[model samples]
Target: MVEYALMLAIIVGIGWLIYNQTQLSDKINSVFNNAGNLMNDAASKSAKPPTT
Candidate 1:
């Protein structure tokens, strides 16, 4: 009985960690995408010819 309880606790902990990581992963992906967009915009502006 004790062994079974320990196994259950370990499984639950792993599941909770995975769920939290999934949420965090989404946030991290958003940050990276926003950074990429900003970089692209800067590059495009710099590539244009300057107006006299």
Candidate 2:
């Protein structure tokens, strides 16, 4: 009975840790994507032919 409870606790703790890590990775990915898009936009704008 005690072994079962300990196993359950360990499983729950591992699942929570995995969830938090995934969330953090997603947030970091979003930030990098936004930064990359901004850089691309700036580069494209600078490369456009100037209008008379």
Estimate the TM-score of every prediction: 0.59, 0.56
Q: Which regions of candidate 2 deviate over 4 angstroms?
A: 1-22
Least well predicted 10-residue stretch by lDDT in candidate 1: 19-28
Q: Residue 34 of model 1: what lDDT?
A: 100
Candidate 1 local lDDT, 1-52, one digit each (tens): 9999999999999988987978977888999999999999999999999999
Q: Name the runs in model 1 displaced over 4 angstroms.
A: 1-22
Which residue pairs come into collision in candidate 1?
Answer: none
Per-residue lDDT for 1-52 in model 2, tens only? 9999999999999988987978977888999999999999999999999999
Q: Each model's C-alpha lDDT?
A: 0.95, 0.95
Q: For model 1, what is the C-alpha lDDT against the true structure?
A: 0.95
